[model samples]
Target: MNPFNKSTGRVVLGGAGWSRQIVTDPTSKPVLQTILHALSLGIRAFDTSPYYDPSEILLGAAFSDPALTSKYPRSDLLLLTKCGRITANDFDYSPAAIRASVRRSLDRFSTTYLDVVFTHDVEFVSREEALGAVKTLFEMRDEGYIKHVGISGYPPAVLADIAVEIRQKLGKPVDVVQTYCHMNIQNTTLQRSLGRFYGDAGVGIVLNASPICMGLLRKGGVPIGELGDFHPAPRGLREAAAKAADWVEGQGENMASLALRYAVGTFASVDEKGLGVTILGGGSIEEITENVETVKKMLKMEDNSVEALDLRDYSLFDEEAYKKDEPLFKGVRDILGEWIDYTWDSPDAAFLEEREKRKNQEK
Candidate 1:
């Protein structure tokens, strides 16, 4: 761990290439204001990607902001980017594309070498494709153009497997692995391996896309993304979300308070070395600031390892993978009205049945 990482603790703010959907939208003004606001807090890490629409451009604007640069030294910060996906719906993992992407990111973000660059989207591609993409990232890392090398994939998928497999071939452990480990679903196999990878391999893991699914567990008929709406639902989907909402809403406090607490605390308590970083997103600077403070409070609470937030990623069917797996939705029972607790004490067969069905499909 470097001085910059230890000082910031284990949290990475919303720079994780997800800025396009939430931050740089038309309605939001003073776009750079959000970045300024986050920097005002103790946040020093920024993850970004050319994949975000005009996001690299917006970050360049923030980096050059006189007031922000004055308050925080430019060299004092860490800026991360990725390659492999550009625009909204495309996948290009060629080595040339990766090089072009990094160079373009430099031009856009107004930064020299990236602090970290991952093989952007590793889930859909095969291991061979991923290795090729990673080869480029490692090349940059070797040139000192990229300080570290990593990969980002969601769910249990290929990235998890590749992270472990690459160790033998690369002769060095991966420096970072960015994945979505949230308050909803548990890739138990992946989670168990992640701690070891971080410990034995000296790999740093970055968590993203939290609070979206968990945020819905608290607020009703509200969407947390850029311009989403929680609307009419099918019997199955509504049943799932509504059941979890029952337990989540009854507490009087929002699930965001509990869920975010669960994420950081869960990883920190059990893993001896602990989760290296978490990158969260929000609607405003206030939202970002609130997230940081909330995480600080949650880490102070109980650290239970069993807490799970699994999301179903049926974008064509629902709110994408961002939905389905939130921990807040665990209150779902069935037509029989049994409470489907995600905890250890639930014995509802209907709840068990539905949960099992989702797992079986992953096979």
Candidate 2:
């Protein structure tokens, strides 16, 4: 049986957005409230990372709170996090660094073991280093510090190829693989690679993150505040996204909502058992509520269903509403045109060269 088949695991609550809040305040009440509200709505899986600075701390506090622990025990929740990528321009895949990072995450989360611990953004490091990190994680798994080992990165093809290599060298398949931006509206490359992940690599779970392309597909354009400047999309993609957002708004629709629904619907429809899980992040309770509602609508759950009724108190989602938005979704895709499936180089060429230079110096 698929371990993630439970409703709670279908949509994972991502912790990166929480890290954005950490920039202004050490602990954010709004983030905590949003998390508590998500729990009340039956969200059980959470994805975080040490690199997402204090995300693990904030989530740890909430998870340890009496109000939360009383109702939801540690065993009932799925805690997923990552290691290796330490900062924006820094990455350490050394076995010692990987082990230290995992221990730190465990300390921050106040938990004995993480449900999943990925070698965050493996593409940034050398292939030998990436495999070494995964092997180190496997060792921790055997030692009972981690339940599963995985990898998360931007390039689906690179990630898929690594998964295959891990299986061949390590003698066992990775437990999970996560790729962001590739499964969203503008790019469906992750969908094309799903067969490779499942059939060739024997991956157990494939997670799709950044359904809205890290806010690029939204109406206001890529957010320009604290967490906005870090977006790596080039001018061409950004301009195309703006046009798509404009067209979507002209039709009296929200670009982000439509994109979210499209992504969830597409992934859920990949196969009978579902080919992927979506990792989503929201800065507020309203946004989180809307995200969960979109998931309910995409899965075609009944209006009177428990999860739906909890989130549907304010907005109603039904087949008629979903069908009405299809054309607008198509229009946005049409506007995207040439930018469709376009992938920008992550850790761009300059950074890769600089990183290699630094590694050589260390040697």
Best by TM-score: 2
Error of 2 at 362 (Å): 3.7
In the range 1-363, model 1's lDDT, one tens digit per residue, is 232344455666655323535433633446578877776666677777776655667776778778777788767777877789764335678889888888988777666777778776676555777778888788887887788888875553355567767776676666777765333322123455555555545565545444334243334523434534322223454455554555666755455554554454444444444443456665467677667765665343223344422110100111222232334333322321422222221123544576478669998
Candidate 2 residue lDDT tens string, 125-192: 88899999999999999999999899999999999999999999889888989899998889988877
Candidate 2 achieves a global lDDT of 0.81
lDDT of 1: 0.56
CA lDDT, every model vs. true structure: 0.56, 0.81
Model 1 TM-score on a 0 to 1 scale: 0.73
Clashing pairs in 2: none
For each candidate in turn, the TM-score is 0.73, 0.91
Residue 97 C-alpha lDDT in model 2? 96
Q: Quick one: RMSD of model 1?
A: 11.0
